[model samples]
Target chain A: MDQNYSTIGRSSRTKQAIEINKVLRNTYLLLAMTLLFSGLTASISMMMNMPPMTYLISVIGGMVIAMFVLPRFAHSTAGIGIVFLITGLLGFGLGPILSMYASVPNGSNIIMLSLGGTGVIFMGLSAYVLATRKDFSFLGGFLMVGFLLVLVAAVANIFLAIPAMSLMISAVVIMLMSGFILHDTSRIIHGGETNYILATIGLYMTIFNIFISLLQILGIMGGDD
Target chain B: MDWMKIVAALALIMFIVYLFPRARHMMENSPKGSSADWMGFVVPILVIVLFVMLLVQLV
Candidate 1:
């Protein structure tokens, strides 16, 4: 009887392991594709030389879709399409800012450096979580608080437009995004998150935030602005 | 100053309003973080900041 019980337990664990692995694989694959699609849209928008204010409109549009449309369709095949659409809109929004920077001295350098920094930070944090398998769910509250604080500061800076304050807010946002990456990845690995679309969204948004923050920091500190 | 800045600020305030309750609930329900967990978060972030500084310098 003990032997049979042990056999059942082993198989159950194996099944669960397979499920988690499947979710992880699918989330990563979709994430890569969405990133590539976003990049394509960004390139197209850049070539068109969009106005700077277009960023606000496109970003707001993307956010509205993400907040309202994504949850309803997350379980369906259409979720994948919606995710691509949201990412593409966001990328298109970014083109105006990239164009602004490209016109400045060493603006392209700042962009490349920001890209390199974002890639490194994302890869490093992800590898650490995958290797250690440490649960970061405890970071939930902290990350949220950080995000709210950053938002408040961001709103204030709209009036202030102080370069120093803007730089500080961007740095803090990058840190908050790192905390979120850990928390979100932990949820997926421990099976708190079962949907790959949602998981990809969590990761994609974090990466997006990190990339933007890095760009701001580089532009400010490098005097590329 | 500009219409874009005004719109941006309003959007940010809305986000803060939208996120506040969820964050409060998460704090109330989620597991309390220990000092070690905080350390785990801070150390990597510090490294990231340093790495970013290095990138700035190199460029």
Candidate 2:
């Protein structure tokens, strides 16, 4: 009886391990594809010399999908399609920012640096969580509070228009996004997150924020040249 | 140099400090891992910090 019980327990653990691995694999594969699609859209938008209004519209559209469509379709095949739409819209919005930077002195350098930095940070944080297998679920509440505070500060800064404050906000966001990468990856590994679509979204958002924050800082620092 | 930046930086620091203990406690109780694994994560952070510092210095 003891032997049978031990075998059953071992198999249960094995099944869980398989399930977790499957989710991680699917999430990563889908994330890579979405990123490529986003890049393609961003490039197309840049070539067309899209206006600011396009960015505004894309931002609103992406938010609508994120807030409404995503949650509803997250478990279906449509979830993957919606995810691509959100990424494409976001990428389209990014085109104007990239164009603005490219028009300035040393702008291309700043863009490259930001892109490289984002890639390194994302890979590093994700690998760390996977290597350590440490549960960072505890960070969820802290991150949420930090996010809300940052959002409020950002909106207020638009009216206040303090450059130094803006710099600080970007710095804070870079750190926050890095922490999110760690937290989200850990969640997937520890089984706290079971849905690949949701997992992909969390990781994608982290990358997006990190890239934007780094670009802001680097642009300011390099623009004078 | 404005008061806003100063205040914002201070607030951010305080929040991180307050949250540090909880994170440390969790890490402490986590499964044993090789030191190399920890370095895998820390190295990236150090690189990112250096990049940020370089940008700030240029400002």
Candidate 3:
């Protein structure tokens, strides 16, 4: 009976590992596709010299899709389309920012630097979580609270119009998003997150925020426009 | 009246206060992260720093 129990436990563990791996694989594949779609739309928006109003529209559209459409389709095959639409819209929003940055002195360099920094951070944090197999679920509450604080601060800073405060907000966002990457990736590894679409969205948002935050900081520090 | 700013400030302060207890709880329940985990965390920091350095050079 003891031997049978041990065998059962081992088998369950193996099955759990397999399930986690499958989810991770699917999440990554979908994430890559969504990111590409987003980039393509962003490039198009850039080429078209889209206005700031486009940014506002894209933000609202992406938020609506994420809040309503994505959740409704998260478990279905349609989730893929919804994910693409959300990411593509967000990417479209990036056009004005990218254009603004591109017009700055040495703007292209800053953009490239921000993009590289974002990629490095995402890959490094993700690899760390995967390699360590460390459960970062404990960070869930901390991240939620952190996010709330940051959001409030961000809104407040807009009226305050304090440069220093804006810089600090950007820095805090970088840390928060980095932590999220770890937490979200660990969730996939530990079977806490099973839906590939949801997982992709989580990771994508984290990456998006990180990139934007980095760009803001870099632009403020080095931009001449 | 600037009620919006006042309400936002109050909410922000309350949230900040709430973080203390939540942080304490988080610390107590934190997982045992290994060296590899630490390395992973540091990678992003280093990348950010490196890019900042690059940007500073341009300036």
Candidate 3 CAPRI category: incorrect
Q: What DockQ score does model 2 reach against the true complex?
A: 0.10
Write one digit per residue (lDDT tens) for candidate 2, span B1-59.
Answer: 45544554454455455546655665555444456645544565566678777755544
Model 2 Cα shift for residue B49 (angstroms): 2.9
lDDT of 3 by residue, A42-132 (tens): 9999999998667766866786678667888999999999999999999999999999998878889888988887887888788877888
| Best TM-score among the predictions, by candidate number | 1
Q: What are the models' TM-scores?
A: 0.97, 0.82, 0.82
Instruction: For candidate 3, give the lDDT.
Output: 0.81
Inter-residue clash pairs, candidate 2: none
Please provide, for model 1 over A57-165, each residue's C-alpha lDDT reduced to its tens digit, 9 standing for 90 to 100.
8888888888889999999999999999999999999998888888898999988988888889988998888898888999898889879988998999999989999
lDDT tens digits by residue: candidate 2, A1-225: 999999999999999999999999999999899889888999999999998567656765786687668999999999999999999999998998888888888788788878877887888778778887876665555566667678667766855888788788988898778878877888888888899999998888889888888889877666542
Q: What value does DockQ give for candidate 3?
A: 0.18
| Winning candidate number (DockQ) | 1
Rank by TM-score, descending? Answer: 1, 3, 2
The best-first sequence of candidates by lDDT reads: 1, 3, 2
DockQ-better candidate, 1 vs 3: 1
Model 3 lDDT at residue B42? 60
- Chain A TM-score for candidate 3 is 0.96
- Each prediction's whole-model lDDT (CA): 0.89, 0.78, 0.81
| Per-prediction share of native contacts kept | 0.75, 0.08, 0.17
Kindly indicate the candidate among 1 and 2 with the higher lDDT. Answer: 1
Model 1 pairs whose backbones collide: none
